[model samples]
Target: MKINKKIACFILSTALIFTPFLVNIHSYAETTSIDNEEDKREQEERERQEEQRRQKERDYYVAVEMYSDFPKLKNDTQNTLTVQIKNTGGSHLEKSKIKVSALPGEISLTGGSSTTQNIGTIYVGNQTSVNYEVQVSKDAKTGTYPITFEFTGNYGTSVENYKAYSYSKTFYLNITKTEKEKDKSQYKPFLIQNIKHPAIINKGDVADLTFSIKNPNDKPMSSIKVSVSPDEGIVNQTQGVFVENNFPANGEKTFNVKLFAQDKAEKKNYSIKLTVEPTNPTEQTDSKSSEDSNETPKILPTSTQYTGIFYNAPDKDEVDGVKNPQIIISSYSYGGTYVEPNQQFPLTMSFVNTSSQKVLRNIKISLSAEEGTFIAVNSSNSFYIDSMSPNSSVTKTINFVTKPDATTKTVAMTIDYTYEDTKGTALTAKDSISIPVMQKTLLSIDDVAQPQDVMEGEPVNISLNFYNLGKTKISNLKMVASGDFTVQGENSYFVGNLEPGKNDSFSISAMPNDPNKISGVIDFTYEKLDGSIETAQKKFNFTLNPISPMPDNNNMDDIQPPKHDNKIIYIGVGIAVVIIIGIILKKRHNKRKKSQELDLDE
Candidate 1:
């Protein structure tokens, strides 16, 4: 009964303690449930707020526009086009794409941005624009060019939200005939108009040039401007002139251009160009086209169609004993012909011209020879012809003379002159004549007055006679002597204009400083009237004797002669006597010595 009471009390105590603990545990569990529910509610509210914010922040909108000039174009004409895109969105549009397409014509996207940022979210009023350029076809018929812009973007759900926006604009492209396509017969023709002058123009001369503008096309022309460009030494009446009316179809316009040539102008032909300009309304039109009826005119050259005359002769050659020759050259007109050296010939040049221009006035011809040669005309003549038309000509005669000592060979003769045509344009012609030179007989130094012996410091006289048996004249004569002698007279003389078979006499005096060392040849050279040179030479010898003194005979008789003669005679005799005595003494001495030796032996 005691153990039962103890157990019951223990059980009651343990139950009492455990009952509070259980209650506290139940309360704690309730608190934990409330916290968990609060946490779940908070999580749900945050998620809802996040979803609402995302829906407000994320949005997509797109637009397109055309950017180009001449968008509303005409048919058969090219036009450039560009399309722009704008994204009216709140959030970045991912995988967003825009495509520009055209109907009926070729289209291309001139490079532009295709990026998420490029098509990104736009704050309410913010916009993004892209450009796509396209070229319209030239041959497209009259129609509307529909350009469509399509934009593709994304929305919230995993499934792609596609909001497609498209807009199109029509270009009223009309086909009309262009200016180039108008009446083909309205095309203008090509023309050439040119002017030419004489080869040699005198100063202060009024020269005329013919201007012909040829129409090469089949159409009639009008409203033309003809312009002239005159260089230095030339003056034109006007810079340009206009023809008010129309030109006949396939016809030429003829006019005369007067060039007031200045005296300062050199002696050569001058060239000028005539330009023609046609009138047109469109400034962009090609002036060279047939439609530009007022096109530049063409220049017709008459000189190219005409043939000029030429003359020539042979050149001269250097030779001995040759007389100067004569050559003649005649020309109907002017050209590049020139005379060569030592040439002998009569030449006539032919002239021709395709145009009907008449050459009037006398052609004044002049002749000139080389420096060493001479030219003489018969009566100082000048060539003259009444009148020469195109392709017609006449000849004039000329004469050239050569000197006696002139080099014999072909020589050149140049003939130059000027004439005026009916148009007042001065023309020139040149010709050459070759003349042959004949060989002339030359006179040598047949005799000379020279001394064979000469004393030092004595003057010696030398005389020479020169004769020319040739047909030409002689001039500019000179003579010189080389030695130990000083020339006291004139060393050079001018024998002007010696005729054929003429002789020139001259004297020279020389004083030699040292006659012993003197000996050499004398050279003579002279100029002949026919532009030639002659040379001759001669040799001389001289001797000089040395001086001596006379002897004296006054003191010859005052000197003695006997003593020296006798002394010489005695000396010779003594020498012979001494030789004989020596021989006799030698014999005696030998006998005595022999006697003495014999006595000693006994």
Candidate 2:
């Protein structure tokens, strides 16, 4: 039986330890199966959406075809071109067109030949055609040239659709070279295209001028140069008037010219002319021996001019109209130049708005004292003024108090204010005013009195007179005493506000339990006229007497009566009841026994 019990206990312990691990494995397996199934379903849905998108594009796209009638032609010979528009897709093309044009310099189109032709609505599986006459340039090289036909219009399956579509097709034609020589200026390799200038130039101000040049031909031009000159009273800065030495072609080039207007020049429109030319001409010789190759290449000089306006400085009247409002401190007044510690008083100050054009609105004045040394009484730190007209002034008053421990010195009252202009733009301004504060805390305790004889653990009352001998009022005055003496009840007392040369009295209860001599500091803390708080202390010393024991009294009156107890009374009552019952039973038994004896005797 013992062996069977041991085996059962071991099995139970093993099962309890591994049960949580087995449950965790089963839960992980279930979660993995759910995540894998969800991923497979999402991927299948994405593939279905992608296939649908590709099918929609195939149903909406439009296609067309175009070509030239002659595959080959001589230079300057006229040729005809044809275009075929087809609606090969499922939807109908509501409107479309084919516009033909030859590339400049390479080929040209006849004047009377139609270049752009419109093809009306063409339904699915329908087509349209257009014809154009074009000519290859006489100077065209022996190569193929492209003529572009642009197709642009709206198309849809229904008449209500407004979708726009644009496409183009270029047809190439083989051109045979012509024997005619091209004019040098007709297809100039270099040209001065344009000039850019600033819109306005104030007197005594500098202007930036830009000249743009480009090569109109496919071949490059070497030794390009640019020159410029300004009209009267306008001169260029201390830089070269002519820019030179560049091999420019096909691409555009820009050069900047810095010009300054004379201070005394008339405030009117002025102009500057710019010229561009190549410093060298085309040459086939390996070495130059002619004037066209050796001389500076002014290939085909081109000139143009640009104009701008100038203005003088504005006057004071105009300046005022653009300026903002200005705020400043005008004046201030206080009850006294100096203050007693922790005395509260009113301070009045004035402010002025110096703007000449606009009215100030939503004006607010905020006040702050030196940190830790002063505070605003009643939290009167901010005041509001609805509005102040231009060159107007306003005054405000606020209560301030100084801290009790603040030193006698001058301090600043910071005034920060914000206002809005007539246009509703907000602006902030700041100013400060200095004020002298007298911290002569002439407060002291006098007329100290206490019992000459005292004992340990005995209660004592000490009395003293307090006075404020400063030059200002001390607000919220309080007195406290502490040290070797144990204070009973309240250790501090309020003496209210004490004006200059004033006195007050109060009493404090204390007990001397340890020190042989009574000694402690009497602290006087109060608020000043500027709302600051501080403390001043006075030390005090007094002798303590030894403890004396009184004689004992032993009288009978002291041992009079025992106190009543409810539990004792209840116990006495129960005992008396038991005795009474016993007596009654005894009486009954005796009477019965006597009767029996009598019967026996009979």
Candidate 3:
């Protein structure tokens, strides 16, 4: 029984896990089907609504046509119009209203007081017509008048259809003037074509003006007076035209007028009144007629006036210890005459415009020193200026110091200025300044002692003497050598602002690879108290001694004697001595025997 219970529990747990997966799949499919059905219904509803809206528009729309029995009529005759409204829809159209409007100065309704009227409701595919009578004014001009009729209809009171359906029609009503009216004379329209000179003229410029007038009148007319009066400045100073003149009908004429500008006149534009008065004063004496004639004054046209350019030249003065003089220096030298070594001199550049127009602003000035010789200093790098007005000028200052060893130097400077004229046109001007620097003789290298001959693997020494011939201070004094040689040592000293008429000595060492063949140039550079650099060069040569050779040690055995020969000589000498002794002894024995006998005998 326990085993059966365990198997049943296992089956129940497995089913529980897979049941959720199956339920989820079925629910997803059902939801998709519902969504598709809803979308189809929504689309059908939208299409039905669109069709209903279009049918409503068709039912509300009304067509209108304008017809006139005599569209073209004489000014003395009466004109009539018949307006028709029709509905060509499948639904009934109701409460239609038609409005008729006549343009101004063309036609007027004869007896009818109202312009708009209501026509009864129109059934499907029905038409309605109404007759309107209008009279053309006798004095109406010969032109076409546009008459418009608007029709409004209602289809079912849906608020939407009431806003959409409206129609309109338009036609022209030509009205011709009577023969007697056309025969009457008409005044031609005239326009002033051009003016030769400006309304306002400068004091020295000419002020000539010319005007063209056209006459389009039908009949001939005479006795016309053209006059002009000066509102300011000199009045009619240059009399170019009389007060009275005559112009034939349908004829044109050009009149010229001139005026002079006085020197004392303030700069301003002058106004002149020109009129075409009647030469025959008896024609219209009433105040009303005279006022009407003067309404269209024949004023001479004019253009704009302008003044010339004017300005003053830059002044020559000193600003902040800097010379603001207008001096042009094409050539300059440092460390000479007017300039001292290690001293900074200030330079100024000036410019101006001598015209009436204001000088342009934002003028840029660039300053640069020539390479190698001149040393530029101070805030004179580059600057911008605001503006220089008429008769105004500006100046800029730059500071420069002279190098200690500088003999004679030249400084070149350029100036660029830009401005706009009275007409707002751009104008540019360029100028250049040259400054000459005086030659300075101070702390200069008088002479140098460079080695003419040096041995290989040995150091070469260079000796130099600097003389302070000028009145200035020299600092950071040192001697340097550069070339194919290695510097072994240098004599450096801070002379600290050398006083005038003082001298200093310095030396440097150089070791060459092949001193015997050492022949090259060396450079010496130093600094002055004013942060200027000085350079000098010298040529040197070196000589070297050759190394000696060593002795050899092979063949010493042949110089000594052998020991065996000495031993053989010694043995031979001993044998000879022994043989001599034996002979003497034998003789002595015989002699002894004999001597003994002789002694016995003696």
TM-score of each: 0.24, 0.24, 0.22
* Candidate 3 structure quality by residue, lDDT tens digits, 1-602: 54345445644664575568546655765675566577668667866766666565554443434344434455667766677666776555677787875455667778864688888678876788877777878766544345787777676655554534566765545444443322122244333455455422334666666666554454333445556665555456555344423355567777876566655554333555555544554351212333557543232222122221111122244233322212112222333335554678766555553444444555555555444333568554667766656546666666767676654444555545555543445555554444555445355674556464443344555555667777545554444445666644332323334566886554455566564544555455656544578766665554545233222221111232322333344446545644765575556556656766777788
On lDDT, the leading prediction is: 2
Q: Candidate 2 lDDT, tens digit per residue, 1-602?
A: 64446545655665576568556655665675566577668666756765554443434666554433544555677766566776666656666777765554666668775667778787778878776667777666443344667876665545564566566755545554333332343335355655666545555667787777776655454455567767777888845355454344466777787877776565444656666555443432112333656543324444444444333222234333566666677677778767656888778887877665678999988887776556778866888999998768898888878888676778788889898987788889787777777866566668567555454555555667777876668887877778777665456666567788887565555666564677777788888766679887777777777577443331112343443444455556556755765676566556766776898899
RMSD after CA superposition, every candidate: 57.6, 44.8, 52.3
Weakest ten-residue segment in model 1 by summed lDDT: 306-315
Deviation in angstroms for 529 in model 1? 2.7
Show where candidate 1 strays beyond 4 Å: 1-348, 353-450, 453-457, 480-482, 488-497, 520-527, 530-602
Distance from true location, Cα of 141 in model 3, Å: 18
Error of 1 at 516 (Å): 3.1
How much is the lDDT of residue 232 in candidate 1? 63
Residue 443, model 1, lDDT: 56
